[model samples]
Target chain A: MSIRQIIDWAIEDSRSQMTGTIVSPFYEYSDYGGHWVWACDVDLGENLGVLRCVPVAANNRELIYAEQGRAVTLSRLNNGKWVITGLAKSLNSTVHYIFMSFTDDTYQVLRKQLRGYIIRPLTYGELGTLVVPYGYGVLPYGAQGKFDAEGNFLEIVETY
Target chain B: MRNISAALENIILGGGTRRPDYKVYAWDPAEATISEVVSANGILDDPAPVDLTPYVSDVSWSDRQLTFALVDPAGLFHPDFGELRHCLKDGAILRLLEGDETVPEVDWAITFTGQVHGQIGWKQSRSTGQITSRLTVFGRGETQAYKRRKITSQEYTVGTDIGIALYDICKTFLGLTGKEMRIPFTLGRQFKHKTNQLAQVTPWDGVCSLLKVVCYQPFFDGEGKLSYVNKSLHRPAARLFEDGDRIKELEVPECSQDTVNKVTVTFLDSQLERVDGPYQKLGQAQVTTGFFSMHETLETWWSEDRKQRADGTSMKVIKSVNSGILPVGSEHYTQLDEFHGQIEVEISVWVPILATVMIAEYLAAAFIPDDVIVLGFGASEGITIPVGRIIQAQAMIGILLIMMSIGSAQYEVWGTPYDFAYLEKKSVAVEDGLDYWLENNLDIKNDFIGTHDQADIIAMTELSWQKCLSMPRKVSVADDPRLEVGDIIGLPDGRKLVISALSKNIKRGEIPTLLIEGCKVLTA
Candidate 1:
């Protein structure tokens, strides 16, 4: 079960600014094999924060990392009008993945969480602390799946 | 559409009657066995006139009993057949040879549930010294054991699902093997019975009759399980006699003027009556719409009423039926065991109606309203009703199950009344009734001419599925191994046919002769 927290966020553009709550835990751990793996947002370059897994023996869980003290402001949106409409958290083992939904269904901030370098356990080597560090290489904004030379997402181009 | 018609035609009509090449296959399910009888009969010395006569018993549903006699030497029996007399106990299949030792693809059949019921003794012929022992067997598929059972004390709501109910009933009561029973027939609108009480009836007959009443086709497959399916829903396998098709003689019987043009089913409520054991009445309800009338009744008992009482402590009885699944799992029982000083109780101390017990009570009736089932919780030792619910005592519904009887439904089929069609009414106690339907085609019409058969539903005012079984047509084409009982085939004249019965001559290595009997259905 993944635990996601929601908070209001502000996207400030010089001329046009819109405010919406941050869809917490935008990253999810749907199919972790219990093998310790890192979830890093660095590769995404959007600095959205990492998604971490907490293996509390009695209640093992997952959560998206929100860098401590980071302002409640969002990453660049390239002028895409999206509003975080609702926030939810799931701790039910029956749920395969956790999510942070936005008003726009087509809004695609999802990415490769387990794609980088690996770790052996859920954070603490003792398995008691049950915390893991996120590790992955940072990519150029365009190289990551966010945009193309024309500022249009290749994913959207191929999907349509 | 696997078209094996051309292949069947070559063998059916192109044969040189000199002892057509074929083999006979018989399946004995009681032993879970199959056999090829290439030479079950020694010789057909006087095969002049084949004695293959197919008799559909009026007393039986689509009596596919293939009756024929073959002479053999005295006391000769196949080792595979133990004691010879018990050879036909549960179900046995008979199909003509399609060639080779392998089971044939095309032929006639029946899982003989009735005994060889005919004589198989010595016979004397006139003028010749060839006195032989003749064996006469009436292979039948009539297993009406569900008729001997009944359901009691339980009430099923009007909206209860008919398919799930029947499936559960057959699984719980019919005692059929996992593979022996199936419910694959698709129905458009499910039936919801008002509380209709039945007393000692046949659920098998009820379900089958209900299928006919609703115009759904139900029958046993080659294997022995009882399953049903809507014939019209089936895609036409092959055109029987298309123009320019390599076909044998096709005969279309003239419509008869003696056909009836109306049918009525009436089912009365049986909730207001006496229960054989110590039980308290719970509740009852009734609803009637011209098509059907439903009534529901329920009852329970007091657990403290029969305490073996060593200390006989006084307590209260619990009223009200909303215990919410009873004291609840282990938590409720633990609470129940903690005795409260004194609380006078009324009605069953525990429950107003045990859902599990009530479901078991009406499982057969609720699911398959036409099946006859009688359920009694348990009349054995190690099985005792749980006692001391909450503050007082009363009979736990699960501890004691009253027998419920569900009456059989009789399906009536007919043409548009103006068609003047002399349709053959297929009388069948479902060997297998399946549930499936296309939402777009649910409105199959039941234009009646006659609906009542030997069905035992008293107030059965109207048939549920307004469709009628009105066609009584028969076609004799070369037998195709791919055909089955409920298959709906298109004829040359654009008339669709649902195969009702099939017969074949085992001695002549004959092709299968299909019986297209039953009420005609108007697909359009």
Candidate 2:
């Protein structure tokens, strides 16, 4: 596709990702209190896709106010790699994690497990990075690493 | 019981006997016939009758009282004459007869009458050689007394009568009169060795003592022999000697050389000088030349030297510092005496920059974020932002920050640089130093262009562009003739476009406002 077309698709996809269906684990504490999980597919029209889930109150029909977690979507570009973007809200803190992305790899999963968040301008092919959304006081620390083929384990290289 | 005259006569006669056979008799008035008969015989009759009646009847002949009642010529008898008669011996001159009557005239009897003048006759006889027995008596003693010669001149010295007066005058003038004047005539010796003894004496005693030693010479008129001179002669002479001549000649050897004590007194043409030396005023005896010397030294030390003035008084210059006077040479800390034009410009541009940097350092530690870097831009075009733009940025941040912090709300800005550049151009610096900085560092055309893009971009958009376009611009009409009604404006290209608005919409209040406008670029 042309660059304009690509930009138009990215814009449309960003909008859909912002407003599409969400999914999360269904939970019920009583007859009057229960949450319904919904999901939407973010597709870059090739092999790259992201499944997003949000918890909606069954009684109120509103999205669940999740704390310390986020909903995200991953898309693949023409280069056959994936970029991720999402909205995150951290409860009881001033930090708000904004849209960010990285490639489709176990490195992203390792970053999600270790750092609990992600950010844009993903660098160092196997080492996933994140934006901390820190204010004047908050600092983020992590070690540089690589993901094995199984993508279940990470190999530490350096720390910063 | 003894008569004084008789006693006196006896004492006088005790030394020598020179009798002229004188007798004192009384005249008998009853014996006048006998006195007549005696006078016929060539005898000198009684000069006056003596009264014998009272004496013959009253006296006893056994006392040989040939009482002759005599009367003095003043008609009073001597009071001692009766006592003299009582002291006469018994059987002495036992006769009772009148003055002219002698014993009864008998054969070969001598007659004793008044005033018998005896003529001594010479007889030449055959048995004896020639005898010259005539008495040659010159004259009888006269009844009047003798007069004495007078004195004319005399001499006196120190404490004699005259000298005492001189000493008194000296003491009165010199406060030394009552004392013996214990002054030294020689260096080591007193003129009068007996001054202590003399000081004890009264004026008279001192005078007498002085007189006993002094040679008194008297000038006298030679008349009678010295033996016959009476007391009157010597007494008056001594008085004159005391009063005049002696005092005039009196000399005090101790005071002879005392010139200060010398007082000359004149009587007509005669002048007398006090014979004292080294005298001063009475109260001033203790004063000396050394005292005056000390006074002069103190005056010299206490008195400051005065500079002579034209009016004859003196004054001194008082040095004072006048900061208003321009300092000469290198000591001046100001450029008041140097080239005046551009120094103010240079100083004004740099001073605030340094001051702001200092203030920024202080603020950065406190309220400002540590990451908020303070760019120390120099004066070069590439390095330093124009001062007008900087000031505008600061004002914008201050306003926006106040609104955000106090109102608890966000604010939006239309992206444009025109407003800020307009504000920078129109805002007048009210102070000298700031005005100088604005004039030198801020080029109006360049500042207008540079801040114009930023102001236009900020004014065109409705987004929260306050942070991206930090500089503030106040809306104002463009004074430049080159700028027109429509313009396309942008900030430096590297920065993002925070917002945009059409200049026409801004003027009509459709968009917020276009604070500044950039250069017009038209495309057909």
Candidate 3:
């Protein structure tokens, strides 16, 4: 089979062997509410895999509106970006996982497992308080960062 | 409160019915004022706060900048938008105001002021599609251009009033002829023979060194005038901070390293000397540099001896590095009373006199003498060592030994210190009598010598000021043209801070950032 076909079959099969919780500010490691159970399939290359997870409403409230792709970036959401360990899924469907380095896409992700949502780069000076995952790093740190009217932290996701 | 510069007021007010939304003024080199060119009041925008450095301590060597992005839709079609390159020149000053008033109030003051240094340029509005310019200007501190211009007189002696000499040097030597020169009027300093021999050092360095001596702070005013005030002697800028201005404070710990308790100003003596050579070949000529410590060498030879400059200042010329070349054929006749009186040899060292002494001492210590004790590597080497001529072979043997050692090293020897002094009315540098720096800790030497021991006190005070009160805080001011960079702002708690940098984005209706340094000591 061709490389692209192999990738497509593996993803369509929905055979997820590995599972972990999405790093989120509002959810604990085990809580199912806002935590996303992701299955990442490593590619032939080292640490190169696709991440797949399902979108769920946090506390079963606000609408889940997003289009998760390879690189999502927004000037306002400059606080937290999960090194989403996959492509994003809509509220109706399950999110598929494809892993690469943490690359910035447009700002359009609002994933929930059971309790809270996972976010992008934290604000400047807010890093010391964050409990970071092993491979995750924060970007966009400065007092002059822009924000939307709602005061949601803006973020840029990238590997250091 | 202090009033704004007239030139600045004229452009900001005269532009149109409204004062310039935000101006980026450059200090004029010809006139002690901001240029009318770069000074434009575009529809000012809220300057983003991220670009400003919160506070700057090393502004001395860095640019004091005012940077912002603005829209200029009319381009050259508008009468208000003149050629901004002149205004954005190296020395341009920036003054920012808040309101769009036709006739502004003193209270509606300039919120920002700095000199122009650079630009990143024209963007157009998406809606109106009008083009705008992003201009950046620096402060007056950038006037120090390291271009080498010769100071005609080798030495300038500062009499009772050093101000006149400072004014002359700034006006003439640095080519700041048209610029206003505001110097301290009080007369007490006796700074003698400031160094001009240093390659690439501008006359502005001389000005700083001079101010360093008198315990003065050198700065250019908003008017672009070069002025320095001995605050204790003259009144400082007005206390402008009042209530109502919002402020943020960040307390910085004391930094002792920036402060100095003492200073020493070192310079060469103006006296000149000509070295005679055995052969009139240019290769046989010796060179002397300002770094040679004459006083150290002199004191080693002449114990308890003191030599003074013509202006009565202590001797500092270690040795004058000579670069003069002697033409051939003229050597025989230039050789006065050839074969008899005395003979000369030349060395290729920076200090010819010291080379002569070192050669004599090296030979006497190595080959001949038993009871001869040489001090300080023979500081008194040329001083009557083999006992002055004392027949022929004694002096000739020393000369021959020097000539023999030619392959090992180079030496350019003249008659003696006495011979050179006789030919040219110069004092023999026996020892540097000013040993005040030596008496103190090796590291704690004063670069500026005060009238009394005031240099130490002044250095310490300046250090304390730099250390304790330099905590800088950055904030975004929305609008109101009355405030400028130098304007002081008093916090609600009554603490004062001096604005070091004020950046405004003319197209965005708000001030993006203000770098306000801690001015704990409120000045008049």
For A32-151, candidate 2 gives per-residue lDDT tens digits of 235333322221211122233322323432232221112323334454333233322111101111111212110011111111111111133323323234332222222223333233
* Number of the top lDDT candidate: 3
lDDT by residue (tens digit), candidate 3, B383-423:
33442323334545544543433321123222212112111
Q: List model 2 lDDT by residue over B205-322, tens digit each.
A: 3322222222111111100000011101111111011111111111112221101111111011111111111111111001111101211100101012211111111111121111
Candidates' C-alpha lDDT: 0.31, 0.22, 0.35
DockQ of each: 0.01, 0.00, 0.01
Clashes of 1: 86
The order of the candidates by TM-score, greatest first, is 3, 1, 2
Error of 1 at B503 (Å): 3.0
Error of 3 at A130 (Å): 74
Q: For model 2, what is the alpha-carbon lDDT of residue B462?
A: 9
Name the DockQ score for candidate 3.
0.01
Off by over 4 Å in 2: A1-27, A31-160, B1-468, B475-524
Categorize the docking of model 2. Answer: incorrect
Between candidates 1 and 2, the lDDT winner:
1
